[model samples]
Target: MTCDEQTFTMKPGEFQALGTGEIAYVKPMTSDDLTTLFPQAPRMRPGLNLWVLLNADGTPIMLSDSRETALANAAEHQLHTVALH
Candidate 1:
């Protein structure tokens, strides 16, 4: 079978079987890492009653008073947005 065929038939966690029994070290996720992996909603400045749009890197991009606008902004920017409750 070709690589493509193998890839298509492979199931989750099956890739571990191809390992050579070598110990793989992985770093624990830091707060910054978590922030980037998940979406964040920060309150806007006082008196605006809005939310600031933040990228995965936690950088402010835009501001909107509605959650839909924030999600739309993320979609327009080709980024995935998630709600953090």
Candidate 2:
């Protein structure tokens, strides 16, 4: 017996909007990366570790020094969190 496989595809925009406001991700970042990823963030000393919560489309939601806080923020917004790597 042989099994059949399913195929799926999406337009670039659709793919990027897959989760949209429904899902978010927590990313571990350094102060050095904040300027690029979250430009509005205030300047901070380099080498400090931080956690950032971002929307599915890579928009910054909030930044924190604790991953738990980031996740809590996601929960507060009713957004599901996705693990990276």
Best by lDDT: 2
For model 1, residues 1-85, the per-residue Cα lDDT tens digits are: 7666643566645654433232211122333333343356342233444445564434456655566676677667666555544
Determine which window of 10 residues in candidate 1 has minimal summed lDDT: 20-29
| Model 2, global lDDT | 0.92
Residue pairs in collision within model 2: none
Which residue pairs overlap in candidate 1's backbone? none
User: Candidate 2, 10: how far from true, in Å?
Assistant: 1.6
CA RMSD of each candidate after superposition:
13.2, 2.3
TM-score of each: 0.41, 0.86
Best by TM-score: 2
What is the C-alpha lDDT profile of model 2 across 1-85, one tens digit per residue?
3368667799999999989899999999999898988767788999999998999999898899999999999999999998878
